[model samples]
Target: MYARLFPIIAVLAALLAPAAAASDLTVFAAASMREAMERIASGFEEETGTKVVFSFAGTGVLARQIEAGAPADLFVSADADWMDYVTENGSIDAASVRQVASNALVLVGASGAAALELEASKIADFLDDQRMAMADPDTVPAGRYGRTALENLGLWQSVAGRLAPMENVRIALASVARGDTPLGLVYRTDAEIEPNVAVLATFPDTSHPEIRYLAALTEGSGNPAAEPFLDYLTGPDAREILQSLGFVTDKVE
Candidate 1:
């Protein structure tokens, strides 16, 4: 009894500008940041008149693309491992790397599902006989964190073989929202945007590595807005938008 896999979320351009101009910026970001990044990009375009072009996918996928010489002005990764992946491959400017935000891990269930504690026995009973939805624990950052959290709580065996693993966090969120699964493990911010899913249990910070989103300029990027746009992401306006969407941006860097 192993986990089942679902279709991968297609990697696609998010904010497509009419055409690439000198002032246009191209960004590669994680799928989990799609909504927040789109909002931040739109605001960046409106305020600076610099059109932003985006590609959203899993952090590992985007990191490999950048390593293979993808043309991107900036890269925002969901975790440091992938950021370190690109940095080690010289795909991004290590000097410009900075922490943008951090997030908490959570368990979610169909809307109106009663919130439950993270205790192994309680979760097992709440789930009954259904599988849980989560990102691919082997590759996706959210899944990796989720797995680690479950293991930390002594609940890994409770749902190990009963998982419906998707390619990314949003897909897992969709699974619970659509009632395709009884529960899901995703970032708190991810659970916030989907109205059909409610937080059931929260994983403590000690359960896994600190979840962080790091942003940096890609190597050899000469786009004029590349640096400024990266700076704007951690600025007051962008931070405000991110916070509104339930993201935590308390970093002083």
Candidate 2:
């Protein structure tokens, strides 16, 4: 009876060993970083045996979730304001925050749409009577960038009522790709991935505040894997992927 019990105990220990040692990481990231983040996380998982899970949404929404005590190991926001929001609310450690990447805004249209130079005066001509798709200007980073760009170009008042606001930049990109909207405003990196769309023109950097993506480990993150994952994002491997994807990685400090 003792020998039989020992064998059963050994088998149970073997079966549960992997589960007991496994580590998982949960990351909240801006919707724009979804593709690049996933690719980087895949490598991270392979290297460290940590299972990475992501929650991708607009920066504002993700920050709000983090502030409300969401169980996220990391927070990667599209702009500093949202990151600041979570930090101020005691959701993430301010010292852990770092800018990972930067991007430019662009005007996008259907892939086959005529290639025309877009300027403040010609925005209406490009859209004709149709609407311009953009993220919700009231809160989303992409939308705020778009609104500011238009305002800086003196085009906001002309096209204010013609805006078709989506929940996030990805949806705004889709609206243009699917021809649901005549044009869209999105990050240059977003325009690069959508084969069904074409970048009509890039907005000048002066049109709005600098676009930056910030990453941080959340205050509530208890996973030991979180720190390693955060380091991976700022390390060389992730930098290469981010640059290849059209994100301006020079400011990744």
Candidate 3:
């Protein structure tokens, strides 16, 4: 009886040991950053032995969640505004804020679709009465960029009524991939990952504000591993991974 009980206790201790030593992390990132972050997080986990959990959504939604006391160790936004929103609300450590990546907006459509010139003057003719899928222009960074580009080129007023707003940029990409929408405006990185979607044209950088991605540690985070993970993001490892995923790393590029 004693020998049998010893073996049971040893098994129980072994099962509990990993749980005791594990460093659990909760990272909130923008929907567009999902794929790249997953790859980066896998590397961070392999090296640090920390289980990095993620919550991917629109920057506005994630910012609101952090502001409302969500258990997030880090926050990564697709644009500066949402990060600014959380910072002003005192939800993140302003000093830890870093711009990690950049992306361009592009016009995408179902595979095999005819290519359009991507000029604002000819954009209306390209739509052909079909609604353009995009994230909510009021809140999503990608949508805001698309809207700004259209307005800058005098195309917004003409196509305003034909916009199909999604909850996030990924959904906009999905809409085009699924052939639910004839056209979508999404980050260039998003287009790279979806095989069913064809990139028709890349919006000119001069067409809108520069797209930027920012990452920061949350104020309420007490995790010791959070700093290392955040560091890895701005470090060389993450830059390589992000660049492979079609994100522009560093400001000079």
Candidate 4:
């Protein structure tokens, strides 16, 4: 069911706090990029001696924070629409926008759970009366993609009220990994990092809009490291990290 998630108010407050010191670069990135982005930032810190700080959240939340002057040096979003939102609102420099990576959507369950067909009638059978966890389908990119996949396959009606939607893709992944939810829908990259979750099925690329990760330097950011870090994210090293984490780094589409 669609549960209200007002608890995020506290989270938003923290993310919207004052900007970082000039010596450190502040980045607001999508939740699904946590592990990979951390690894990449660590490498950047080692190589350039510039510290990188991050605020990871859903694309919708990050975009809103940026719009309200979150003071982030950079913004990376899983959904292009959210990036467009920030860009249109003057939160980020539109000219610096670039597609960094692409990802696939997947259905996952507890590690030992059996896999099932990605069919319309079979979805309910697969759920087995338990709610399938998902990101907030209305605003979150992964959730929106999952819902669109189900709708495209005529399975939306079957799972209508049978959801345990969370705030972001990572939370949904965590829920299934911890056995709090038997099933969840998340990015392939997100599923790979959690050993306790098994990929039950992958959503067809045609089932939803293209899944692309876009990065950009925040509009009028005076921090010198901002542009460099954004470039590093799309560099070979970052691409390698993204591919190792199961993200499609070959092309943005």
Candidate 5:
């Protein structure tokens, strides 16, 4: 009886050990992607029987961390520039890099804020005294695009004084949503999640650089689980999840 019980327990442990080990994948992603990525990660874990751990922050900040030898299996950057930084530093696999999604910049105003309208002409009048929030253009891609759009529309020079720089796009969006700033330039997905903000207008494609979200595996991860997650990201199910979240799927482009 003791011998039979011992053999059964050994078999059970062997079956469970691999499942337990597979449940630990570390993913570093952009702060603006937190909400959407978390939801997708949960779904991925459920389907693949893997656990996901995430670190979220500005793409530039995350890139620096990766360059400094942070142990991350995967990276999802808010823009291509930071991903390039990682690849240039030999921190990520250049061949594994892929454009996963696209985001649009939008002017978001506080709920019921009448000072700003979507029209180009009204933007100038709206900028006269109202404070506008933005991320630091030097370190944040969304902010850089915001500045470019303003400069292209001839608003940056006139409204530069009223600009309030935040740490990241999500922070800028929060400022407007919370009424700390009357308006902000943020991703359409960011605006969509904030019920307290109204989208004034989406920046025309010609107004600024195209916003591309890129993903890649970090170098030296060597985790067998990492490739599966990457494959899941490019699969049909993940594309559907991205599309549902207002992210433009690669198929659309």
Candidate 6:
């Protein structure tokens, strides 16, 4: 009787030990990905019976944080450039990097603003009294793409004085949505989140660099749960969610 009871108690303890030791994985992602990624992470947590913690900001800032020893299990960057930065620095596995989603750059404006037909060449005309908002091009990929589009359309130099640089694309979108800035360049998904804003125009493919969303597991993450989350982001369910939020499914070139 003693032997049988002892074996049963040891098995129960073994089972409880793993449950108690299970860790919450930390994911650092770009500000633009916050809405969709949070939903996906919530679903992942429910399905896997694990906890997920997130930190969202500009990809450049997140990369710098990770380089400075921020404890993160996974990273989702707004573009390939910052993903490359972490990979090159040996902070994450290069082979684990995958393009998760793509986004189109769009010009947005307050819903109550004048209805203007925006063509690539006519973008500057829309910026007359309206301040145009964008993320800081020096630290945000979306801002760099917006700048490139403006330059390609011969509007960047002319509109330089009319620009409001936000910390991230999400903030730039917020400025337009709140009517603080009448116009902004942001991801199409960001515009979708704001009922007060209207997408005035999408940048022509030839007008700017393609925007790609990339993700990878961090190098020193002790959490083995990171891989599954990365895999889930590329799965059908996650893709469907992303599509519903206005993200493009195609990979950026």
- State the lDDT of candidate 2 residue by residue for 9-84, as single tens digits: 4344334333322357888899999999999999998999888988787887777666656678899999888888
lDDT of 4 by residue, 85-123 (tens): 888877789999999899999999988778878876677
Candidate 1 stretches greater than 4 Å from native: 1-23
Error of 1 at 207 (Å): 1.3
Question: Against the true structure, candidate 4 has what lDDT?
Answer: 0.86
**Per-residue lDDT of candidate 5, residues 179-218 (tens digit):** 7887798999998888999987778889987888888999
Highest TM-score: give the candidate number: 4
lDDT of 6 at 183: 86
Q: Estimated TM-score per prediction?
A: 0.90, 0.89, 0.88, 0.93, 0.85, 0.86
Where model 3 places Cα greater than 4 Å from the true spot, the runs are 1-22, 119-121
Residue ranges of candidate 6 with Cα displaced over 4 Å: 1-22, 114-125
lDDT values for all models: 0.85, 0.86, 0.86, 0.86, 0.79, 0.82
Q: Residue-wise lDDT of candidate 3 within 1-253, one digit each (tens)? A: 6445533543443243322223688898999999899999999999998989888888877777777677788999989998998899899999999888999988998888777785655667777778999998987898999999888877789778999999899999999999888899999999999999988988889999889999999999999999999999988889999999999987721
Q: In terms of TM-score, how similar is model 1 to the real structure?
A: 0.90
Per-residue alpha-carbon lDDT of candidate 6 for residues 1-253, written as tens digits (9 for 90 to 100): 6435533543443233322234888888999999899899888989998888887878877887777667788999998888998899999988889889888888899886665554534556776676789998877899999889888977787777888988799999989888788789899889898899998877888887778898999998888888998899998888888999988876622
**Candidate 1: worst-modelled 10 consecutive residues by lDDT:** 5-14
Question: How do all the candidates rank in terms of TM-score, highest first?
Answer: 4, 1, 2, 3, 6, 5
lDDT of 2 at 43: 95
Q: Residue 7 CA error for candidate 1 (Å)?
A: 16
Model 5 lDDT on a 0 to 1 scale: 0.79
The pairs that clash in candidate 1 are none
lDDT at position 142, candidate 3: 89
Clashing pairs counted in every model: 0, 0, 0, 0, 1, 0
lDDT of 1 by residue, 1-253 (tens): 2223212221222222234566679898889899999999999889988889887877876776677666789999999998998898888899999998889999999889999898878887887898889998987899998999899888999889889888789999998999989889999999999999999888989999999999999997999889999899989988998888888889827
Which residue runs of candidate 4 sit more than 4 Å off their true CA positions?
1-19
The residue pairs found clashing in candidate 3 are: none
